[model samples]
Target: MIRVLVADDQAAVRDGFAALVDAQQTMYVVGRAATGRESVDLARRTSPDVILMDIRMPKLDGIEATRIICTDPALQRTRVLVLTTFDLDEYVYAALRAGASGFLLKDTPRAELLHAVEVIAGGEALLAPSITRRLIAEFASRRDPQHPSPQLAELTDRERDILLLVARGLSNAEIAGRLVISPLTAKSHVRNILRKLDCHDRAGLVALAYENGLISPGDQP
Candidate 1:
């Protein structure tokens, strides 16, 4: 079973999400929290596989709580999936940087929400291509394109090419089709890149790609 924790300041929404998750045969809600701090506490206690976290909460905000939980060595297996009211929420990037695997709008269709939880639980980050482009463009505007992460030098030419596609929001299967490689090969490359760079998931690769100037605003996929 995939253990999950739902964290939201609103009781109704929290309960609704918990119910939806519990209905899934492959998933179960381990706990519910109404505040960011409580979510972190529950996360540590439950060691859930995935957390549906609200961005705005009492006592602590989701970003800070995500950072706390994600940075904790004991919670290393936990992945946070942020919940926001808007697709283009300003705080979403910060949550990703704080170690969240991905995010979803609160109004996301029930099926999509459930699928997102499963995706995160399976160790993949979730960001729609459109959202990825717009969000990265908006945030990358403030950053210098010349700034680069030294660790990027460790990547091979093929790995660099794959990383660029990943930052453009291509999934393993899509990347395989585009590069004429097997899906397994694409997945293996991604896993190696994550390990070499110390990233939590694909979302971290996107963030790293931008932060390290691998791709910049207005770059074509």
Candidate 2:
């Protein structure tokens, strides 16, 4: 079963989400929190597989809570899915930087929300190609080209190419077809890149691609 925790300052939204998740036979809500700090505490206690976190909360913010949970060695298996009001906005990006596995808009369809939880729980980051492009565009101009991450040196030519494909929002199957390799090979390369860069998921890789100057704003995917 996929263990989940719901965190939002609003009681109605929090309870509603918990109810929705509990309705699924494949998943269950382990806890609910009205504040970010409570979310963090509950997470340590429950050790849930996924957390649906609101970006804004009292006593602390979801982004900071996500950071704290993700960085904790004991909670390494926990993945955070940020809830936002906008698509591909600054808050979502900040949450991703803080090690969130993915994000969804607050008004996302119920089916999609459940699917997103499953995907992140299964260790895949949910970033559609279109959303990835917009995320890159949203922060391209503000990127500090002069201070690229030194971790770029850890990747080889093939890995660099793969990273660019990931930044373009290509799936492992798509990348395999594009590069004339098996899907498993593509998946392996992606995993290697994630390990080399110390990233939590594909979302982090997309962020790193831009932050390390691999993919720039206005660059065609």
Candidate 3:
């Protein structure tokens, strides 16, 4: 089962999320916390598979909590899916930088929310398309204009191609179709890219791609 810990300051939100998570046979709500400190404590104690963290909580905020949880050696495998009410909340970016696996709006559809939990738990990161575009734009604005990292030199030619497609937000299957490779191969290349680049997931890949000018903001794949 995919164990989940819901951390939100509001009781109603926590209860609602717990109910939704519990309804899924593949998922279970392991614990709930109404404050960032409690969330951290529960995460350390339960070692849940995933954490649904709220950005704004009393005592401590989600970004800091996420940083602490994700950086903990014992909880390295615990993925944090940040929950926010605003699509472009500043804390969302901060949480991502702090190693959150992904961010989801509190109002996300039940199906999508469930899928997100599954995706992150499966060692993948997901971003809503609109949010992804915004992230690209923000990254573009903040890019340092430095030359690409030496790590890019370590990627094979095919892996480089796959990285570009990933930065463009194409899934492994889409990349497979475009490159005429099997989906498993495409997925493997993506994993290799992440390891070589020392990136966390697709979002980190996208950030690195834009920051290094591998994919331009005006260029749509």
Highest-scoring model, TM-score: 2
Cα shift from native, residue 108, model 1 (Å): 1.4
TM-score for candidate 3, please give it: 0.85
Tens digit of lDDT per residue, candidate 1, span 35-110? Answer: 9999999998999999999999999999999999988989988999999988777798888877788888899999
Per-residue lDDT over 49-81 for candidate 3, one digit per residue giving the tens place of the 0 to 100 score = 999999999999999999889778899789899
After superposing candidate 1, which stretches have Cα over 4 Å from the reference?
216-221
User: Against the correct fold, how does model 1 do in TM-score?
Assistant: 0.88
Each candidate's number of clashing pairs is 0, 0, 0
Candidate 2 wrong stretches, greater than 4 Å:
217-221
Tell me model 2's lDDT, rounded to 2 decimals: 0.86
The weakest ten consecutive residues by lDDT in model 2 span 124-133
Candidate 2 local lDDT, 1-221, one digit each (tens): 99999999999999999999999999999999999999999999999999999998999999899899988989989999988888868877888878888778889899989998988898854455466556655775577778877788889999999999988778888889999999999999999998898887788888877776777666664
